[model samples]
Target: MITMSLYSEKDLDIELLEEKIIEPVNKTNESKHIVFIHGFASNSSCWELFVEKNKNHYIHLINLPGHGSKEYKPYHLIFKFIIDLIKKYIISIYQNYGPIILVGHSYGGAISATVTHELKEINENIIEKTILLAPYSKYSILKVIDKIKLFQIKNSDDFMELQKMIFVNAEKTVYELEKYLYKKLSLEFFKKNSKNLKWVILGMSLPSTFYKIDKAFKTIGSSFYFLFGEKDKLIDNQKTIQRSTINNIQPYFSIYEDKGHAFFAEDKDRFFNEIENIINL
Candidate 1:
């Protein structure tokens, strides 16, 4: 069974928010600590299969800011809020154990990269290694398009139509989308902090962040790997990887040719094997 715990940052007072720590059934003294961060609108439940497969490794799964059970706070500084959360949780972990390996999915990958970059500046040994799954890299054209899409207000019909386009054919995809929208946008606090939410979207849509990541990768010596699905509808994996070339952050990358954005779910066995290879290395 997965264990639950609560953590806090001074900025947020509500303690109902929880982070789940799933431990391997057979623990070992020499096991490595691996931290997994879920993407936007996703909670730690996304890592349930991974945890089951790699129970031998200490897995720390967290719900990102403004998502999961965490309290909703609207701040214009979205990245700053996320970074603060990372710092607090990571420090707490380090205090109890040692440095950890990070595996992040989608937006979680962006967070992992950003945190690794920040940590490398002060302590090179903060993150033992990092893996990015279907990470977002900023491209000029896409950034421009995203900016245009964000500000362009449409009729309710058009908005609902666009939402449909965002989903995959999978039934689970619709369920996940509904849960995410409800969790993130349903809160009254979210409406009051709309500007911050916009900033979060715009910042994520910028290629500038990826460029910074490229530079940071060159300086940080930690091993990095990337995994993506060939049929990903939301992100162009090739373009994202190509953009990474700008900073020469050559990661060991693999593509699930037959899978979509939710490739891990499509074939957990293959995904688990690939992850085991990376982790054991």
Candidate 2:
């Protein structure tokens, strides 16, 4: 069973939403540590399959700020706050176990890239590798535009309805849609940290700001891998892979033909297999 713990640092408090930490029953040691980061509006539960499949390895699952059991407060600092929080956690983990291989899904991918960049700047050897699953580069601009457009609309009901149209998959029922949105938004967190949420949503959406991240990727020396669902509706998977290629980073890329935005959740076997292959290689 996955272990659970609560962690706090001054004003910030987070639930250690971990999964499967026991040593293997067979007594073989796994060399690599894997940390999974879920996408926007989602929590650590998204990585249940990977955790189940890779029970032998040291696996860590985390919920981002303003989500899960973490305290929700407006953090005007945005990415800086996230980076600092990750740095603290990484350091704490390293004290016990060594560096880890980072894996992130969607928005989590973006955070993974950012964390790798920061780690590379501080200590190139700390982050062994990073995997960006269906990451967003240029597409973040679309979200920024959507935010602006959303803020301008008059009625809250209309805005909420439109949000549903944009984010929720068309085939899902209302209950599923609500669950999906609630998981991501953690509406209570939003209510508590409304201003910070606004700044982060708007700030991250900007193309110019995202470009800085691209520049950071260029300088970071860690090996990178890109995996995406071929049918992802939110991002141009091919374009993202191609863009990563231009960096001369030589990332391993995989496109799952039958999957979409939530590929990890939709096709657990394939996702876990890809991860195992990456780690073993």
The residue-by-residue lDDT of candidate 2 on 162-267, one tens digit each, is: 3443333424422343544533354444444445445556556666457656765555443888888766766667666666666566768888776676777666
Candidate 1: which pairs clash? 24-55
User: For residues 196-273, could you state the per-residue lDDT of candidate 1 as single tens digits?
Assistant: 445556555545555654554444343778888777766668876775555565668898886666677666689999
Local distance difference test, each candidate: 0.63, 0.63
- Residue range with the least summed lDDT across 10 consecutive positions in model 1: 158-167
At residue 212, give the lDDT of candidate 2.
56
